[model samples]
Target: MTSSAPSTRIASKLGLSDRIFAGPRSRRLLSTVEAGLERVDAALVRELAMADSLANATSRYLYDAGGKRVRPMLALLTCQLGDGATDKVIDGATALEMTHLGSLYHDDVMDAADKRRGVPAAHEVWGNNIAILTGDLLFSRASQIMARHGEAAIRLQADTFERLVIGQMHETTGAQDDDDPVEFYLRVLADKTGSLISAAARTGLTFSNGPAELEGALTVFGEKVGVAFQLLDDVIDLSADPDETGKVPGTDLRAGVPTMPYLLLAQRSDTSATALRERIDDGVAQIADGADPELLDDALAELRDHESTQATLDLAHRWSAESIDALAPLPDGAVRDALTRFARAVVDRSR
Candidate 1:
């Protein structure tokens, strides 16, 4: 799994331009993620081959838009850390990533997102029906991989998948309601993002027959980091260059999804959020390009300056610290450092 350091292109993109990890150890962890992608591709191949021509094109569009494949990497790293290394464990890692990608395929349709990972989304290129079918196929393949392990792994994966779907539905409900509290948003993020990451780490433990206590600790760590990740993503959406984020800014705002930043801003303002929403609806038709751009920019600036952003960052920082602490009890080595650095890396990611 070990290999050389990342290229300058990767280093710059990952915000590792400085000596954050700063040594050979960081390189090995990065190499492991790259290596995991190779395994993930093999699983993706089976799903893609089973799809119809249009579906195949849509699936391939997503495949070509390479991502970090963090879920699989998490499984692999944790497996090694727990003194559990086997083909089954590797397959488990692959399965987790497949499920994650599958959900993204569906999410694009649900989000009506035109792009993902800087490329056109599958649903945008292909019809919604094909996009959904492709996602179902991926989900099936993930299940097949899980079944190969045993009943226990199969059950875990099944339960996780169920939770994932439920989380998606919960988020949709919140968006439709439009007045959801920040706490509800966190709950949706946990079920949607946290459960999978928690399962990945726990799957590694299952392979190793590691202590129950350790598994529970890692579960907490995963949930917290998952929440932190989404918060940072929201923060980035409000501030990062559209080119860098690979999406339109104020997208969540436009969709009327009450994210933490927006919720925070509304809380600070004298006007009620419901009243503000009504105004936006009424005013949208009349907003001139010149006037609207300036107004939107000012609103975004205020949202960024809201105490909520700092509060959210503080929470992210603390959770990342706790993630490292949970793994601290593991034997100290480059493997441990790699995971810790990964947690730190997520917090500081530029895009």
Candidate 2:
């Protein structure tokens, strides 16, 4: 693929701007992240290739469609605190991104999602078995990449993958009878979303020469940011334009997937909330009985405008704020400053 010059738009994707990464070195830091992302993008394309034409096409499908590069950006940004995108750092970022891409295939299969990244989901195009295999193929390749970094990296990848699986399992199974649904769901977000992000930052630090003291802080920061990002996604799921978010609104509700808003709404006993809950439940049932999800568009719009949506956004903001607080342990520097901007960017994406 031909490359374009790194522009302000690319930097903006990571929430980087002169105002945020400022002082004499601000431009330098922004340039570094842009350059690193370019390299990571190129590396991802090369690594995703295969001997079979079908495997190659399936692998590159979503990559070509486009993503925000959030995981790789986190990896690249954190690695800057150390050796500034060394070869190992680039490799780590590439592997981490592959892990994320691979997971999406499986997620789409599980969600039975029809579209992703603005196009047909792999499962919709290739069938669930093929889509699942494609996802596993991506994960296997990612594992091979991590193996090159030796035992510590391998173990880290394993632990991260474990969290991803466990998180999905919890989400699929729902909260236990004894579990606090809200708390349980937040933990699921941490495991499913936050764990991989946390690993990306940690892997970057491991591959580079970042200080040991920075590890704990970056880990907390990455995971919390992950949870916040997902929570924001819950809100977004209810309010998308389809043109902008590349997703139909209320896909979660249609799937009977209980998002933050659904859980919170279930807890409220007020008249409006109860009335809204009844409408949502009926919508969910209709979808379950094979009704088209679009039929429930009116109800989703109502839920989106309800106070529960605001409550979900507030919860996301809280997680984002906590992620920023985790950065306090890091030394005052451009990296920390940029990470603060990045965390805010995750929450601000909803706007």
Candidate 3:
């Protein structure tokens, strides 16, 4: 398929455009990846196009808005260790991104989020029923693309889909009586965010004929890095200005979502946290009722400056370091170095 070179924004989003292109060899690899990503973009639009005009528009909505495309980038990067970006690898990357986009539509509905990627959420534009159906349509398209790759890819997609659903189910049901809330939250992050990422990394190996030994390492690396990424986002959610994050500060807290910082604060028995916890609870209730914006804003500002927020940041660094450690088994080279930098960037990203 014909495609243009990836834009600077797309390259920066993958965390490896200008920075990694220092040497001729590195520049060539970067060009290859850029070309592959362009193909992936084309494939996404082609596959998501529908016979019905309304269905086509809704399916293409999020794709047009753009995203980090981290999953597909990981898939393409790992492919460098093997046969590079083959047609199958490109298709695999496209399918993974489609699955991710589909999940976002469903996630927005569940979270009652008004916006995604700086635009109105699909649910907000088309109502919940159409949004949910659009997500299902994308999922079906992903499966159709995966089916072309073979049974293994299909199985991987199915397993990841199951994990995504199960993770959402647990999040909705909340923790069991004996469950440690912190542990429960981490598990949810792993299944919900990490599983698909792990699959994306593995798909590179599966499609590109990479060394089989590296598969498990990359999978673990992806999962740990995903969790670390989400943890960093927890900190960002509290600290990021609206312009940086494209969402209001304390959005999750206002929605009563149990973020890592909040969970950590809840575990503290210190008197300092007692007042903070009460205020947070009150803020949640107030926000839910659309009352007392000033009080909620004050509580959010307080929590943003709290020690638990710092603790959450520290935890993110720890996980990112663990993700780097997971790559110890791989041979030293540009691919491994790029992956390392990518993991670090996940925790360090400002937006």
Candidate 4:
């Protein structure tokens, strides 16, 4: 089920190799996607290379660290429904991936994170001001690429960018007094993660002239899959070893971020919940004040094994299933099958 060298990392990282090469048709599709990804990778290097040496180096930092390239792959996969990767589709894919990479720089800054893709975060290396500017540069470059595709692409890019900002704003502000914490968290996930993913899939279809009728279904699929992907990330935050996920376990908890498991725990009124709640509340404050690492580690271990974490995993599976269901309207073929497999793989991150 493994692939050869270059695409092997992407396929293994995403657990997509088996599904992608499952059948002869799927193998052909995989070859096509790998080829497009190669082009996208080249474009990433060329696009991020700026006349300003500092900007170029800073912007290229995360790109060189390596990522799963899921966004661009989603864009490429959807393009198979119509004509395969045309020049416009490749440009759109490149733009979408650039947008994703830029968001990571800003995200690490916002989270005060130390590492990304196994390297020091851009902010950690170059300082917040330089890191923020690098993100802006990449974002502008993405817009410039979209602009070449015409007004519609520009509008889509603008709208997606707006959603991304609003999502971060809501996450920063926290849920309002009357807001349902779970519902609010889901909305934030949709805005921050799902919106851009929907745009990525739709952009491929738009650029490659995929069937107009399937646009709505693919959009729904992308958004749901994106939410599922992030929810699984929430579970992974608690469960995955740092080596596996490339993130410190319980990083969100330490930051006082409201992950799905935490939000779910907040809703429980039973006696069993009281001790965990107290531990979390106290642990968060202590970690913020540089308290005992042993205490925080113990609390995180308990929370990771808690029922609430399992519930979050269940929700992720539900979303993944719903995403696959959205693909029901598409014809039965390799593309549809791969999309379904992708949805399942998105949730499978919990393993």
Ranked candidates, highest TM-score first: 4, 2, 3, 1
**lDDT, model 1, position 110:** 82
How far in Å is the alpha carbon of 170 misplaced in model 3? Answer: 1.1
Q: Model-by-model lDDT, in order?
A: 0.68, 0.83, 0.83, 0.85
Give lDDT for model 4: 0.85
* Residue pairs clashing, model 4: none
Give the per-residue lDDT of model 3 (tens digit) for 26-63.
56667676777778887886888788989988998887
User: Which whole-number lDDT from 0 to 100 does residue 342 have in model 2?
Assistant: 72
Model 2 over residues 196-304: C-alpha lDDT tens digits? 9999888777788888888998899989999999999998888758755666777778788899998999899999899888988988888889988887788788888
Clash count for candidate 4 is: 0
Q: Judge candidate 4 at residue 112 and give its lDDT.
A: 70
State each candidate's clash count: 0, 0, 0, 0
lDDT of 4 by residue, 1-351 (tens): 111123424575476778655777677788788888888887787787888778878888888777888888888989988888998998998998898899999988888777788778899899999998888998999999999989999998999999999999999999999999999999999999999889988987888999999999989998999999999999888764776666677777777887999888888998777778888889888877887544677777888888998999999999999999999999999888888888897787644
Question: Residue 61 lDDT in model 1?
Answer: 62
lDDT of 2 at 219: 93
How does residue 48 of candidate 2 score in lDDT? 89
Task: Tell me the spans in candidate 3 whose CA falls farther than 4 Å from its real position.
Answer: 1-9, 12-28, 290-295
Error of 2 at 219 (Å): 0.9
The list of candidate 2 runs beyond 4 A from truth reads 1-9, 12-24
